[model samples]
Target: MGNCIICGKPVDGLVCESHQEDVVFEFDGNSPSQLTPDRYYRGTVDGYADFGVFVDIGDHVTGLLHRSELDRRLESLDWEPGDTVYVQVLDVRDNGNVDLGWSIRQTERDFRGKLIDAPDGEHHPEDVETNDDEGSASAGAAADEAEPSGADDETSSADDATPSADATVPNGRGAHAATAEPEPVEESLAEETEGGLNRTTVDSIGEQVGSVVHLEGEITSVRQTSGPTIFELRDETATVECAAFEEAGVRAYPDVDVDDVVALQGEVERRHGELQVETEALEILAGDERDAVADRLEEALEQEAAPTSVDLLADHDAVSAVRDELVDAATVIRRAVMETRPIIVRHSATADGYVAGAAIERAVLPLVREKHTRDDAEYHYFERRPLDGRVYDMDAATGDVTSMLEARDRHGEQLPLVVLVDAGSTAESADGYELLAHYGAESLVIDDSRTDEEIVDAVAVAVAPSLAGADVDDVTSSALAANVAAHVNDDVRDDLVHLPAVSYWEDTPEAYADLATEAGYDETGVSERREAVALEAYYQSYKDKRELVTDLLFGDGEATRAQDGNLAAHVSGQFRDKLETELETATENLESRDAGGAEVTVLDTAAFTHRFDFPTTDLLLDELHRRRDAAFTLGVDEDELRVRASDGIDVRELGEAIREAVPDGGVHVVGGRDGHVEFLQGEREAVREAALEALEELTA
Candidate 1:
């Protein structure tokens, strides 16, 4: 027999009228006595709900509190798991579940007010008397609802029913006597260390021409041919070309200007055409410093051209040995490692440790082995180990024991190809791969994103996408398409380093439709190259804009100036190189197919905006002026033309007269809708020359 939990009363022979007789309450038969309730304790809560909390609270019974019965501020408290709270008895269900209420809210208002007025008995004896009087009145009313033999049926003694002499509520709020204050919040701080680089401050790398110091800037200019690639960087004073190299790595912003602020961190290089320092990281700060530098640069551009002499004897002598070594096998391997190829490491193609197909290994092995330096290739043994982040070891010599990750701080200094392992989610496979990634080797974690075959195919396409289309399904083709896309992206980045502000031409559905009508491809070779070409064009145009901006804003003593007008030439050359590489890889993978069917796609754009860093476009206006001079020999009075253009006066005769005033017989025409015109082929130049001769009569 369980005892009444609330009052600790014996319950074997006892039954209360409202509870324990049956599941339902009865209006009669038992005395009108309140049941011995469950232990009802109020707990501090983040919030209260009419229904119970989803979590368990020790006993088999769950606890709940009605919304009206809880304190209003209880909802405001920030509570978490394992917090203590206080509660009072309201009503309990027969199943032993408890419903709690707040007694402070249920207490008489007059009694509460008295307590609030005088909290201590010594300070407010009169208030205590008033509280007692109120309690006595409440007790009389409660007795009316009590059992027929109310006084006898009641369990409390006279003193228990009587209000305590010292009990008082402070300021009409609930008594805080029993409730403990909450604990202070806990927080953690990150540790600070020395040598930490600040992004905002300038880090001087070297001196340029003894006139200016070189600094790394955060403003990076991106040019896309097919994918996004960074080109030049805008420093405070001028823009510099960002040279990215596959083997030796990128060195400096090509044409750095004096007082130009650059935020760069890396080994500094200063010699000949490669006057910029190569950086591991760089950031351009924003604010008045940049504006002031730009203003100063513009002012300097107006000065008479200074003698352009470079004193490179010391730098040339210093870089002689290092430049020679940059052409070594080690450099080639370093270049190969930066490609970030996704490799599929299969222990065995079959379940029983059988070797994979020869063609697969033959195609992949050469690329991987190329990353090893001549010395590393000569004596390095085939060892099985988890080299870097989640990489497993599978030896070509003997597929056996796995290994641990070795801590090599110098690993990043060397190039290690990133590879993706294809395996099921077994503990052995996961641990092996993780070990490999930890060893300075990047790894791709494979899940449901793609299937094993798709993963393998992606690797194949990534390293060599120009390969003839594999007889793979649509799913595989889509995955392979994405892989080829990554390669194109990297190629675009590579292209931008060499190319100037090139524009990008996106392959729209209409472009694809046109491409599809022109030629057919193997299911795998669908007209993606068309789209690829368009993307490349877009990047080229984008590069052009950056060059224009740098030129207009910084003025052209900088090395980046040479990159202008030659982007088309560079793009054509690079496109050929990329195509050759892709074609070679494609042919190698598709030995069964003939190469005669292979073809290249060309892409073009109609209109593109020139991207620049400033508001002024005088460079374009100047070019227009030069063209104007070549086509027409006559010019109208500046004031007369200005008034005519402003008042919308018809000047077709004047335009013809200007066209006829040129020395050469060139045709005159306007390209844009807004009255802008140009001189072209025909007798217009001669007519303009004759007209100018006539106009000279007035001046003479």
Candidate 2:
């Protein structure tokens, strides 16, 4: 029996049951079943497979370290055959398959205590009998005589009875430090070793520059430059780049990888005003020591990266139903930022979509800045793309996959988190979501549109009122995204409060409107910003134009004043003029007809209006729908059709009828319930006649 080293409790070994996981054990057993489960063991890297690594624990037992247990990608592992590694014995199945888990600690010295687990039972190193008692007694006498004056004789004797700090044993190498009198080798091997290394955190690394230091952290990333392999290490406090050079254009420390916990011993140096470590030696930590490091990091991350509990920004019941989803979405985005994963936001090219995308961008940029020490992290981390249509089609998915794959190969970047704002809710986007999923990329959809139920299975997180059994009309995409953004980073919640109001063209929710009003954005200001964003969204539909959009929406009084001809006023005027002019021409060209019981207004958009004008066909259709008093309005260009009707009309049903009536017209519901359709130019007249007939049937 012995006293526990950590808690000072009586035990059969150096540690007690509660602290058993605190120490790493070296397995001496010959078979898999002899190995104790839940205990970390030092193992040898036997080989590798596509799925995981094979490790040999002892002469007769081998275990499989599956890749799923790894914290990072499998391709990033640098382990080689014959390298000593630390792993935890997770299980020994009935078939004698020993399942292993990766350990963060690599060296025996990092562990608090060591044990030899044999087929018979667990045995401490001190339990082994030796014939060096006379030598041990002489060493104890020498240690006691050299003790400090204030130390009690009993304490001195106790300290002398234990191992000396410098005593060596089998440490992979058989070399031992010779002394006149040596302590017991088993006790020496069981004790932890620091070896005069200055252990420090990454945040305090600045003070240790020009000095050799030891830091324990998880490798966030590894980039191989022409000269050195740069391993980006992040502890709880901060992240730093450690450069290990074998030679020019050669790899260094080939066994290390991103997410591998390692004890790094190096000299801190300043390169280009950034702190980097010039690695002298890097060791991957494993066993109980590794578990402790991982546990510490996990605890720190839980404390720092967890999203704050959201207080409902709006008090609507519709918003309350999916409050958990909103928080989850926010947390996912935040966690992605901390993990250095790039975020790609795909939103519809509409006012509501732009507002929603911009709100997330605003919330995420500050976090990117705060999390990464790199100057260009904002650009490297976040990207916002405006989709040409509401659906995230195969075309869009292909483009995203192509670009992200290129980035991965060229820059060694992780695949981005694809965030769909005000888009990707319908079944039409399923193909796109699947493409992303096939590549192992994560996706999120936050929309207020009526979505198909199948979309729930296609995405990691889907936050839509329709999916939550709430009325889709009760909330706006901007409001949902704004609430999510507020929770993503609460510091910018006030900045995003005005966004939901700006998204509404009419009947802005009183709760969100009041929020905007309190934030000094009145109805007129909101309208101007909305109109301006819509106009600008057309010019360069692909680019996010983040700064320009920010200036247009949240610019101060001086920015809005006409003295400088602010972007908001200029674009808003353009929007009004273009929309009004289109409305005038459409009104003059309107052909009124009675279809069944409802009044229908049909405008030949190709002949009467400018097709290639500032206001798009969809925008013009929207304006005409709002101004006209008919039960249903239909706009037809040469080959395209746009329809708007009261809530009583089923656009999908109308579309189906139109397809049946005009077989070769290629009629389908293009927009989700918006009633847009397209046809071959040859079938325009037939399509128009068919649409009129279908409308009459629907109104009946």
- Highest TM-score among the candidates is held by which one? 2
Taking all chains together, each candidate's TM-score versus the true structure is: 0.19, 0.69
Candidate that scores best on lDDT: 2
User: Which TM-score value belongs to model 1?
Assistant: 0.19
Runs in model 1 with CA error above 4 Å?
1-393, 396-417, 421-431, 445-473, 481-700
Report lDDT (Cα) of residue 78, candidate 1. Answer: 38
RMSD of 1: 31.4
lDDT (0 to 1) per candidate:
0.27, 0.76
List, residue by residue over 108-158, the lDDT tens digit for candidate 1: 221211111111101122333454777654322332333321123357532
**Stretches of candidate 2 exceeding 4 Å from the true structure:** 1-193, 204-213, 303-305, 557-565
